[model samples]
Target: MPVMPSSAPSVEKGPTLRNDSFSDRRDSVNKLETGCLSIIVLGASGDLAKKKTFPALFNLYRQGFLQSSGVHIFGYARTKISDDELRARIRGYLVHGKGGPPHTHSEDVSKFLQLIKYVSGSYDAEDRFRLLDKEISKHEISKNIQEGSSQRLFYLALPPLVYPTVCKMIRRFCMNKYNHGGWTRIVVEKPFGKDLESAEKLSTQLGDLFDESQLYRIDHYLGKELVQNLLVLRFANRFFLPLWNRDNIDNIQIVFREDFGTEGRGGYFDEYGIIRDIFQNHLLQVLCLVAMEKPVSLRPEHIRDEKVKVLQSVLPIKSEEVVLGQYEGYRDDPTVPDSSNTPTFATVVLRIDNERWEGVPFILKAGKALNSRKAEIRVQFKDVPGDIFRCKRQGRNEFVIRLQPSEAMYMKLTVKQPGLEMSTILSELDLSYGQRYQGVTIPEAYERLILDTIRGDQQHFVRRDELKAAWEIFTPLLHRIDDGELKPLPYKPGSRGPVEADVLLSKAGYRQTHGYVWISPSL
Candidate 1:
């Protein structure tokens, strides 16, 4: 195990990393958001708040998205720290220019820091939430904003277990008053629940407290650049519209690989394992976008309706086709048990039973302590009808979308070698964002989602029915793993997971492209 990351404590708190960045979801931002906005960070002193939540707010502030005068930030948690102390704690993490390389802007950081005020409070207490409400109301009154026309965004950066009570408190004491031109919204993070029943129950709890429209079940993966691009790449391109079906594409693979182990955060990793931690929410969300039918329109409900259909169409996971592996040294973390059955790696194949995706397997693979760190989607095309040059031996035609560690998309193509004699070799048509876009700054996922919430856009956030459909597909497999009916195979760290996983991939009808790798092109 390696030394714990400073933000490791929050790993279990929530997927602060459930966060990513996004842009171009809509045609444009339209205009600055209306009303005086009070952004409240619940569980303020936690790692998720400091690392993901606070940094995201600061970024939005520096950008023109958050008007400094209208937005007042508040931090609420059980940690009894002074306002200055809380700001100082998170000061080290507030840097500018995320993605590629980072440089801190002290002036922007200090100004953003001043907007934040801390209030110490327990999660389940009504009085505490009321105090929070008082602070927010005070800010609104001081600004001379109308009593009930102030936007209140409560960001729950705490654990899933306390969501019910925290939400209840928000409902009873912290809502925007019954006034025109103002609304209250709550943004909750993922790890929604351990499985289907719990997820449904959590949904019921939150649903009862607030209307579906007022809630944002944020999964940062949806905010990813590539994931957001899937819609435009599919529907807008006439070339792909004819080719993106089971008749043309052979199989699809959405994979996530982490080159490092749990370090000192095994307690959280052990309980959730790789599947719950990555596959259930992240990979599955990506799959929905990759495989779903084009929506009737770009409206939030329309886009999400298609996603739910894809999830509902998914056939149950086959035990014979599933591969689970735990890294050899996973148990070394004092937080993990010696005899743990948790898997650090998982490869499962999902087949959608719809007209477009029938018989086409969607392979989902995720792991920790692997040889690489990347999350990507690979679309493998079927063999060419007439292979005159026998290019199949070299590689299949695959479109690889690299999500991170350099965002790029390239298509593996068979090209004629430059020679007197006729010859064919595999090459790629590449689009590296770094080289192509040059200096465009992509909005971080949390910042974008938060902005969406204030603007009443649910297109990028998960819907209630979508969440239930997602859990339905994985609940059985999760239950089997919990009962020990499905145990993880052991594999060495820094290696591609268990060899059997490759066998599973092959069985799922995905042909591996050997002896060729797509490197993100540099200028």
Candidate 2:
């Protein structure tokens, strides 16, 4: 374990690490004991592995969450780089231009680097299976020689296409060997597939190799402190629980818009578009957490069971209710040149058949090449009907939960302006996290998630059934677009989105909550 430098000043009373302050009390003597974790990151040379994964692990090490003496990391990839090369790659990414923590002088990093051993192998070849097997055996031998047991965490940082092959190889050479006295957990990345059919097939294939419990379906959003706070805010706060349903709430909206387009990753973006690329896993997962019922327990299975139910309850979208948009001409974008592909933007009005959210429209919109960058959820309450303030200009009360540019939550309620025309005015009761809590280190999404995986907590991870249920809700709309039954609306780059997006909400006899909508000012 690396001791943090004593010379570095410590912010002892910093802001809370997580959003929620209230939690169920566990008996001090009976709490579950977490063991030392050994993680093996596949595709260690990849961008995600270096930038996100390594930094996250380093944070964990600095926080003393990981055992310094017992921890081991193996970097497996096709590249024939030396151990020092791998450490340099990680170190460069950590110290990259973001002004992160200083690089400490300690043997911990060197020892960590010594544990990293690379093996050359094809991503999808059976002959490489032997090399993969040898790597695992070597790790086990090294661990036993140093300590005792050999528990392993395998993270697949490759693209979606290689997931199945990697799982099959793990089953043949890794899983069976680690079963008896040790445990094996695998982390899979997103964009599981292009659509429902492919997703199902991929899920089935993965299931054959690993049990559902051993699989950690990664979605970095859930790892965010604010994202995790969604659950605690509703469940832990007594005052908010009564108003968290259809009777008190009006409608919910989730927006995930990026100012820039694919940014040269267009070749990859063209295939999945905005729907599969972001909405399928990231946006929907947020919706589930916001709308899901309180589970019986905080156990992974219980939490996921409730989420699956929420997804299953979502009413399937018909053509009349759904919206699609594609950004015009991918000229400079090499991913889709002269592309007639569907919109880089889309919005859908979904209703759930469940008692809690029957009438409320769960509006979801995600796009690329939009005017501004934002990711937020706004819950709009129904207007106070036929009230004394019926003559007021403001519409309704709303609660906004922002996830990007900052992490915060606030509510918009109508208040009477002093010495006004006996009328009401709207103002915000804001809770800006950065301003409210000075000098808080909100861990990056991957940092929190990697720690969760190390601790064997799957509450933040997605479940197989939840994935299937999500696919079920979107499959119909997916087919409509794929079969040309639904034509995508055209919108210019650097704009909010297609006019059809506005129309989608208009048809519902509603509009997006102002300041909550995706409006980009001239940059």
Task: Give the whole-model CA lDDT for all candidates, comma-separated.
Answer: 0.84, 0.73
Best by lDDT: 1
What number of clashing residue pairs does each candidate have, in the order they appear? 3, 6
Tens digits of per-residue lDDT, candidate 2, 1-523, equal 2122121112111111222122432322111123234577888999889878777776666455554444667777888887788888887665542334446524445544565666667776667767666766765565453232345688898888888888887777665253333467789999787777898899998988877767889999998777899988889989888888889787788999988877777787767767777778888999999999999977777888899998989887867877788777654665565734556788988888998888888888999889988899988877677787673345678888888867778887877778946766676787777777656567788877776665566888888888889888887777777677787787898998988778778676464544433222211
> Candidate 2 local accuracy as lDDT?
0.73
Can you write out model 1's per-residue Cα lDDT over 204-316, one digit (the tens) per residue?
99999988878889999988888889999989899998899989999999999999999878998898989899998999999999998978878788889999999999999
**Residue clash pairs of candidate 1:** 20-445, 21-444, 21-445
- The TM-score that candidate 2 achieves is 0.87
RMSD in Å for model 1: 7.5
Question: Which segments of candidate 1 are over 4 A away from where they belong?
Answer: 1-34, 96-104
